[model samples]
Target: MKAQGVVLATRYVLVTLIALLVILPFALMFMATFREHTDIIRRGPLALPQHFSVDNFRKVLFQHHFDRYYLNSILITVPVVGGSLVFALMSAFALSVMDFPLKRFFLLGVVSFGVMIPEVFIMIPLFQLMHGLGLVNNLLSVILPSLAMSACFSTLVIRSFFMGLPRELLDSAMVDGATFWEILWKIYTPLAIPAIVTSGALTAVWTWNTYITPLVLIHDPLKMPLPLGLALFQGQYVANVPLIMTGATLTALPPIVVYLLLQPRVVLGITQGALK
Candidate 1:
């Protein structure tokens, strides 16, 4: 009993220390946002703030044009998350429940292929395609490709969950005259909530934080998303550390909020999926 107690205590202590190490930098950054830039420079970021204010946040949101960039992110992420969820669910449903030929080919050739290919490797072709379509500086250029990319991965996730569901349950539903769409939306979808949220949350964060794709395809300031817009915080020679940190904090907030809102199901979905 004593040996087991010692081991458990050591585990808790180690976990606490690791947690602090991970959290302290972000904590300092959040606190520094309330302090003046000059104060952070003079006292160091580790020093406690002399006063608390939201001036840096205001400056970042209004003076720095982060608001426009934020709006751009919203416009892009919303469609990617919502649209890709629908596509992934539909494709996953067909793959999981229905019998069809060429199914394995579709899974391996297209879905797995999308997952394995590096996003950076396709930038040139993607850029040329967007340019040819006159979507070079349009949000659609980012939205369309991101939607497709997310759908492929999400399909795999939801498909695993669907496949794990009991065969008898689905067969009984069909005997009761449930149509394909009816089984998917009314039956599997409700049961697959956790998997759906997991995929949606993951896609939302990826789309929101994407820098490379937008940089390659978009040049107009108006079309740039939040991650790309972070470049505006630096100059030829100087960078405002606090201002940049504040923007970084704000940029990271939405995904964090979304995940927390759906955290319980996300955890449940991941756990169940792993067990399967």
Candidate 2:
């Protein structure tokens, strides 16, 4: 009993420390948003401002056009998350239950391998491809590649859930004169909600924070998403520490809200998978 209590206490202490480690940077950013720019620059990031104000956030959001950046982020993130999940679900269904020649090759050689390769290696080729398509400076330049990448991971995760489903369900559905298409949508999909939600939430978060793809492809200030926009905003306001942190905080806000709201579904998906 004493050993168990000791282990539990130590485990909680470790988790609390890790939680603080993850949260401290955002905490600092939020704190800095209300602090003086000069206060942060002179006294470092940790210093308390002599007076707190909302002028920095107001300037970043309204005067400097962070709202435009926010809209650009929405334009890019929405299509990527929606399209990626659709592709992922269809592909995952085929991979999980359907049979076809070269199926293993496509899964192992293409999809799995694509995930292993770093995005940096393909940036040049991706940019060239986008340029060839006349998509440079267009939001589609970011959306297409992000959708494809997000779909790959979503497919892998959704497939596992589909594969775990009982074969009897499919056999029974078929006996009732249901087609494969119906089986996929009418039967399989309902059971895979947790998995789909999990995939979607993760995809949404990644698409929301996409920096590299936009950086490599998007050049127009109007088309740039939040991450790139924030970087440029920081550069333009080089001396204004508080304004930079305000942009960072707002840019990071959406994903944090998304992950929190969808957290229960994520946990449910993992729990269901584990039980299976």
Candidate 3:
């Protein structure tokens, strides 16, 4: 009994330590946002601030023009998430239900391979294609590519869910004179809530944090997203750590808020949808 008690205590302590390690950075960043610039320079990062102030956030919002960037981030993330979900649903449905020659070859050669292909590998070609179409520096460049790339995981997930659904359900819908569109809209859409939330939230968070493609494709500061805006907080000689933390905190809020809002449904759906 004593040995078992010791083991349980050790496990609890280890978990607590790991939790603290994960949380400490965000906690310090929150403190740094309110810390004076001089305090940040003189004192170590973990030190308490002399006076807590909202000045950092003020500077970020008013001085840096992060409002526009925030809006831009929203615009990019929303379309990407929504479009990805739509495409993923259709692709998954077709892959699961539709039968045609070379379907397995196409799935293996194209969709399966696409799931493993890193976006960075094709950045150059993607840029050239966007440039050819005159989409460079335009939001469409990001949105279109986002739609094209989306979450391969979502396709796999939705496909799994679709396959698990009873064929009789689709057949019944058909018997009732439901077209493919009706069956898809009425049945699949309603039951695929979990997959949608799981996929949409994942895509949204990714799109919100998208930096590399935006960095490469966008030279126009005004057209950039929150990630790009956060970059502006640093300068050559002096970096505004407080302002940077404030900007980062603000940037982190949207996806967190979104996740929180849909968390219950997301959790429930993933659990239920995994079965059928």
Stretches of candidate 1 exceeding 4 Å from the true structure: 1-6, 235-237, 264-276
Q: List clashing residue pairs in candidate 2.
A: none
Off by over 4 Å in 3: 50-52, 235-237, 260-276
lDDT of 2 by residue, 110-149 (tens): 7787556667888999999999999999998888888888
Worst lDDT 10-window in candidate 1: 231-240
Model 1 agreement with the true structure over 1-276: per-residue lDDT tens digits: 999999999999999999999989888878877887788779887898778889999998898888999999999999999999999999999999998999999988998787667779999999999989999999999999899989987898999889999999899999999999999999999999878878888778889988889999989887789988876555521457788888888887887788789888666655754464
Q: Residue 79 deviation, candidate 1, in Å?
A: 0.5
| Cα RMSD (angstroms) for every candidate in the order listed | 2.4, 3.1, 3.1
TM-score of 1: 0.90
Task: Give the higher-TM-score candidate: 2 or 3.
Answer: 3
Error of 1 at 243 (Å): 1.1
Q: Pick the candidate with the highest TM-score.
A: 1
Better of 2 and 3 by lDDT: 2
Best by lDDT: 1
Give the worst 10-residue stretch by lDDT in candidate 3: 231-240
Whole-model lDDT, model 2: 0.85
lDDT of each: 0.86, 0.85, 0.79
Output the better candidate (1/2) by TM-score. Answer: 1
